[model samples]
Target: MITNQAIEELVAKECERYELERSGFIADRQAAIRELVAQTGILPESCSLIEFAEWKERLLNDWYTRRRFAGFFHRKSEKRCMFRMVKRLLQNAVFRLRKKQTELTLDDELKMEEGRTVAFKLSSAFFEGFYKKTCCNGTLFVSPGHLETVCIDELSLLFPLKYPLLYARLTAKDNEFWEEIWRLIRRFVRFLVVDMGGKEDTEMIQEVSMETVLSVQEQMERGKLEQITSARHLLNSLQMTGRNKFREWLRTESRKREEILLSEEDWGKVEQAKEDRREVDTCGANRRFDYLLDIDEKDEYEVCCALVDVLSYGSGKVYGELVEGREKLARAMLLLYVENKPYEEVVRILYNTSDTSKLVNLRKSVSRGKEYLKKRMADLIKLYKRKGEVPFATE
Candidate 1:
């Protein structure tokens, strides 16, 4: 409640000489402040000059906001007008929230979980091929088992001529969105490079054909990318409107188009991709799928999986081979580093010394595989920000 002393202090401080000396000019300050205190408690903290100033500003802004809408309903009784304003406020909030949701979309785990298989053919000698591919291309595999080459920087794709899959596929009304996705992918690629050593091999290293990684990808999963294309087309066909009734109706109509867009078998193929992932996540350079992870030690993959599950609404499944391979190679490399194995010996440990025949004279698959794994390790580290991933084989 407003105290007599507080009112007297404010008026006394403001009163002019004549007003101050004037007879019995007692203000109706007690009732006025007590009502204010009843409406808004006058706590000890609120009594501070700075806090009072801030509170006054908030009160004025709120008053202005309410007044703006209050004008529209003022014809109604004050109680009725207040209720009408509340309804308007709720509607306004709903519309704004819908707009925000429209700006962002929930990515399907099926899509996020599918890693596009890529192939890189090599023609140069071991060291030379290694140098070329290593310096040129990168991938952005964001989904669980699949590494979506979100960005292929400083390098170009040859086959299907579909270098950037998203560009080749995604058709969005907002051009800025495509650019933003590209930027995020580029960031992911650069992170991978920096994570892998971000450095070119000081000397010549091994190299491989695009066929190997490509074959591994195909073996890991199946189905042509026509589905991804159709899914995009279906997505594009969607109307971008905010009317609640319209949007609900659109969802129903889209399902019919989806049946036309994809057969039951196709949906099963993509949706059932988790099985392929389970098979793929098992294998890497030397280890099997389940073998790659340090089951006893909790890891970044664990964290990544948790995040994916949350993002995908708990049904997200992460699986893949080369990623498994990369993790394995990285783990082995870390072990090797600890063992103080030299470069040449490390190479022997990686591919087994028996395959030396694919040598200096010919551009062999060995070199390409080595570089691929190196790049893969780099990619994982870049994506996850976890270090000591490429463990050298110590034992």
Candidate 2:
């Protein structure tokens, strides 16, 4: 229903709008770049837009590489304090060496004033080529969507900076500069398609509605739209019930997936996999305790059997002695060790408090409880070994 004539008219209107605001947009971007350069001191002040853009790309790339390396090293050396200290010292040394090398290279390059003039000429030529590629005869293409895509892509290439500008020391304002340009282009396209009142717009809306209905029907058949009884119901519910209600329904349904009916053999395989995982976890836990206790390799099986029985008896006595009127410590130990809950979870469950002081007290109590239990267990094991029996007395 949309003709080339209508498309051309929309494009022409958009082009006229862009031309009117082009100078202001360019000036704003130039000012922002100058401010960012001043703040970061990453680029020379005399550098033109083209030089600055290139330098920014290189700096961001270097920053990303450094961040990735730092993350990897941190994770690998998490438990090694000495290794981490050594790494920090080495990194500082390398940074100083690189800084010196950069200074030497800058001294050898041409003077700043001459460089600025040449950069300005190069930037002008670059913009000329950029305009030719993005426009046909200095006018936007007839297809609004295509023109929008082309403009956005060209703008992104010109300014490759994105969010999380940590390395460049740039602020959100730098990102907003490019975003504003994209918004202007998108606003023009949206105005033509959505706000413009004409036969073409009406036809376009109807076509889109039909496509939406078909898409909903397909999703329903695939069991993805579980809450909606039908496509019409979905449309009505979304429109009438409002976005909040629709969002709640989506949130609930997103946690569930379409049920996949499997054969008996497949079910059997899944069960077997779960059982194997449990066995592996049990063996791993046992091995961890054995290593912690430093059990002799030759007598591991015999010592493990005796230690299990000793632990069963000793744990009860230790718990009773520690919890004799201290209900908070008892509950904390139960939630921390018995339930295997995290410190925050245990604090919440016991005191129902997120206060920092409560968390600190809970941690201290848990640490003392752990030491008492370890001492009791060790004494019980030594007694059992000495006399072949553990006495019921606390000592």
Candidate 3:
């Protein structure tokens, strides 16, 4: 029987010729596949579906194959794919995750199976080379590619597929000085300040206490405008009027009352509040929020800012090296295969396979590589509890 991989490739390949010369996304996908195949070339001349499947079976054997592809459709909470939204901004957070590099395909039958698995034996030297050559102090990730015998020092860097949307909300109206962080607000505009280390300068609002933040909401609520029913009206309200001077002066006096400066623990409380305002699903508890920050906590800021920028900007000597490492990851697609011998073969030689009994060693190597990468990814995330701090932290 034809494997799912074969079916997909065949369908895409055949469909490309009939449709294409059309304009739009469908045409773009066809062109992308054609280009990839042209650049990477087709499978080995004799790599037929049955022979490949048979080779896969031998490589995994009954013991391992049963676990990896089996029960793939089980109601395992994390494994099952789900949909989430972020209103007017980008929807669907590209799930940054890691999984085993497997050649076998999964569909109806394979999804229904249960618990067949395989493992690989990786060399310690390879691990060291993988991290050192590919990363810079947990900031950058090396490019991904397999079946290459090259050292990490000889890797290429890869960038994110797209730049994440980041914007600092401008609280002050008619302010020409605060022009730098004006992002295209596809969603509702929200203004709040963050204190990674300093107070707001460009476009960022000055950090205020949690009590003041809550008090602002309460004041709006007493006026029967808790909904912030109109964006323009809220902005106008924020501007001081002649009659509003008295209340504004009162705020200034009360602000002096807060001048004692909160204790460190109390400060941590604000940090935690800021985090919660983002509505991030940390620790698995869902708390409700009705204020401006809670409703429009910018998701794009955290991941792209804290993670991607720091990795590139902070890596003194390793920046170029990380780029090379990431190039390997960009080339991977469903049907691509790397045939290479062990350490003796040159890394650039795509079709070099070691003198082995069969495909068993290749699968084992993939299994080992998957586990090693997954563990390292987890370790790197501990440095930053927030997803915005690191690009691949979500993985």
Highest TM-score model number = 2
Candidate 3 wrongly placed segments (more than 4 Å)? 1-212, 220-223, 226-228, 240-395
Deviation (Å) of 280 in candidate 3: 62
Off by over 4 Å in 1: 2-170, 173-176, 187-226, 229-395
The alpha-carbon lDDT assigned to residue 257 of candidate 3 equals 52
lDDT of 2 by residue, 243-297 (tens): 3323333343343233121234544554453344333233233221222234332
Worst 10 residues of 3 by lDDT: 82-91
Candidates ranked by lDDT? 2, 1, 3
Global lDDT of each candidate: 0.32, 0.38, 0.29
TM-scores for candidates 1 onward, in order:
0.15, 0.20, 0.18
lDDT of 1: 0.32
Error of 3 at 46 (Å): 27
How many pairs of residues collide in model 1? Answer: 34
Worst 10 residues of 2 by lDDT: 164-173
Candidate 1 lDDT, tens digit per residue, 294-380? 322234333333222122221112223233544444434333322435445655666566343222211223224434543443354
